[model samples]
Target: MSLPSPSPFPPPSPSAAFRPPRLLALAGPTAAGKTDASLALAREFDAEIVSVDSALVYRGMDIGTAKPTAQQLAAVPHHLVDIRDPAQPYSAAEFVADATIRVAQIQARGRLALLVGGTMLYFKALFDGLDEMPAADPDVRARLEREAADRGWPALHAELAAVDPRTAARLAPHDSQRIQRALEVYRSAGRPLSEFQQGRPGRGLRPAALLSLEPGNRGWLHERIARRFDAMLQAGFLDEVRALRARGDLHPGLPSMRCVGYRQAWEALDAGWTPAMLRERGIAATRQLAKRQLTWLRSMERRTVACDGPDPVGDLLQAAREVLR
Candidate 1:
């Protein structure tokens, strides 16, 4: 992709000098044109792209993550995209730490840092910072996993209700992972995760601007999602999933495996689902993810720009330049 021309706008004033390094965050739902827009903006600003996506963190999980291709990667440097194995876990705290280092490096090089992704939680972690939650206790998690396997998530839900009713009330009965996490935290820390989050001060990095691209037409967005899934299939998403599965380290319920397309692919493999069924499920899951992204964007009021037209990249760069000015 060709780089867009530099913005004509002047930089921000000196009074804003004490601000943390200016970060351009491009966020939107799946297929809302974040990748293309970030690429263009990075070129225009001489910035490096730091991915805030959870799925893209895992190695050997390419096509479904919609990771940039070798050609595209060569166009501009991208950070934290494929830094971990499928079996290893990466968390929001880790993201913030790594991203902080990357941002500093980008600034030292006299370039800006542009974070781009659809992962709402990742973006939230960067901006609001994570609570100083305790590290996961493997023994506790293993015990919970065993309980879930034996008696199922309802039993876990009941346990959570007894200890942390607030979290239990908020989670669905079938939301095993979150329920388990809540219970684990309550047991280990003697406090609910929500309470911990509330106690934390504003420790997150505030971006210079937050640009969100939301299509007014859901139908159009869904169509784009379907097309993108089809392209992923054509681009070997299934093979990538299969390779990750063969690693014998990834479980379907792990955070990495639970990413939209990955979960669907795992389910298809487990149920002996046909190729057509897998593709259909993947597309549906991606659409749902997009809806969630839209909801997140809508709830964030400040520094948000809604793009409803065809040329979101053009509008996004113009908006970023405006923010810089």
Candidate 2:
């Protein structure tokens, strides 16, 4: 007893006193009100927000990306917003790494972490880890980029479809990043990119509470897309694009400039298209974006809280409570 006495440390706490790390993923199509709902949930749970949007990472991409206002940022701390320049390259792999670290840090500080955005690929990459693939080859990439420039991305997409129909079928023709990468992998690895992904389940970032916001009515969703694009125009979206163009460093081929509204805006400015025409094209692109997001949502294997009604915030809160309990 004397030998064991005078231990420097107190007795270990009961296991019941510990709470395992928990992450809330608020995912939805664009303009589906994820921003508002996520902010509400974050406030309720003392969580910090980590944006999952690809476009929101770029600086000077505010209006088109619908980045959080300064006021909103002040109320609830957000990570990974405006961390990259429009010309910089960021990928799902990088996002997974950075977000994983952020999640751990937030938990260490005795706070919850909420990943909020419309970028499904980012969500998928974080939750399900990426497969091993060939590294980027600048020479191969440059050649593909040149081919795209001369023959158009649709032509390159057709080439991909011929080689790897599985991946190509899921990717849009205008999805330059995926298209280029798939072709590069093919050129370097001598196999289809999809083949590498076949039958190999991702390691994933462990369990998370998933919530998806989708409009019950397709028509309603389309209307929301249209209205949101119109609001962007009213908010001087062209001026924002013009400011980026004024930088003289940004270009249409760059990932940042290719963001939905920004791409359409650039084409309109270059073609001298009328405002109404540009507006129509922007809205249509946004609708397509929503469609792609919904398709991904539909493919989820895990059970999620699907909030299709008007009260998304309420739905999210209720579902989160159940998951935490």
Candidate 3:
């Protein structure tokens, strides 16, 4: 895909010796045009794009994740994409550490740091401090997986509800990966996950000047999500998943496989789901992901721009100016 020309969008006037180590974030739900807007803002401000997306970090998962095209990546310097193999796990805390270093490095080079993507959890961890939560214990996770095998994930989610109602309330009962993690934390730390989430500042924007693209019309976003998923399918999303499966090192349980479209495609290939089923389920799952993303965005403090109509990047540019000015 061709990158949008920044010529039409005039650059902002340089201020008198601006603050150093500056950061800006362009956040929105999936399929809401974040990449295009991010590219424009990064170019106008001479910013390096530091992707805040969780899935984009993993290598070889591009087609489904709507990752920036090669041409686009060549056009703008993007940090944190394709940094890890699909077999490895990336946490929000890890993202914070990597992004912090990259942001400083970009500023050191006399460029702006633009954090951009749809991963709300990573954004939260970067802007707001994370509590000293226990690291993921493999033994605990293995135990939870075994118990889930016997009693099923819904049963485990029920157990989690018993310990961490606050966390449980936000999660769906069937979300196995998160259910397993929450239970693993509770079992290993002897404390509820909710407790760790508490006492940390709620919804912060630490050094990143925040701008959000929120859809004013939910239907418009839904349509966009559906159309985008279909486009991904046509563009060989299944082939990407097939390649990952052939690696034999990855599984549906891994964080990389658990990404929205990849998860569905994996199951479809395993269970012989029809193309119609894959498209239907993939589109539905993407819409749900977008819904969860919008929910996360609403909780944070941000300068909002409507993403529905034309000139959203223009609006986002204006919002960034407001935050930076």
The candidate scoring highest on lDDT is: 3
Ranking of all candidate structures by their lDDT, best first: 3, 2, 1
Each candidate: RMSD? 5.0, 8.8, 5.6
lDDT for each residue of candidate 2 in 226-295, tens digit (9 for 90 to 100): 8888888999999999999999988887878888999999999999999999998899888888888888
Supply candidate 1's per-residue lDDT for 138.
84
lDDT of 2 at 30: 91
Ranking according to TM-score, highest score first? 3, 2, 1
> What value does the lDDT take at residue 270 in candidate 2?
97
1 or 3, greater by TM-score: 3
Candidate 2 runs further than 4 Å off: 1-21, 195-202
Cand. 2 Cα-lDDT: 0.81
Q: Which has the better lDDT: candidate 1, or candidate 2?
A: 2
Alpha carbon RMSD to native, model 2: 8.8
Q: How good is model 3 by TM-score?
A: 0.90
Instruction: In model 3, state the lDDT of residue 90.
Output: 89
Candidate 2 TM-score over all chains jointly: 0.89
In order, candidate lDDTs are 0.78, 0.81, 0.83
The sequence of per-residue lDDT tens digits that candidate 3 reaches over residues 35-69 is 99999998888999999998999999899999999
List the candidates' TM-scores in order: 0.85, 0.89, 0.90
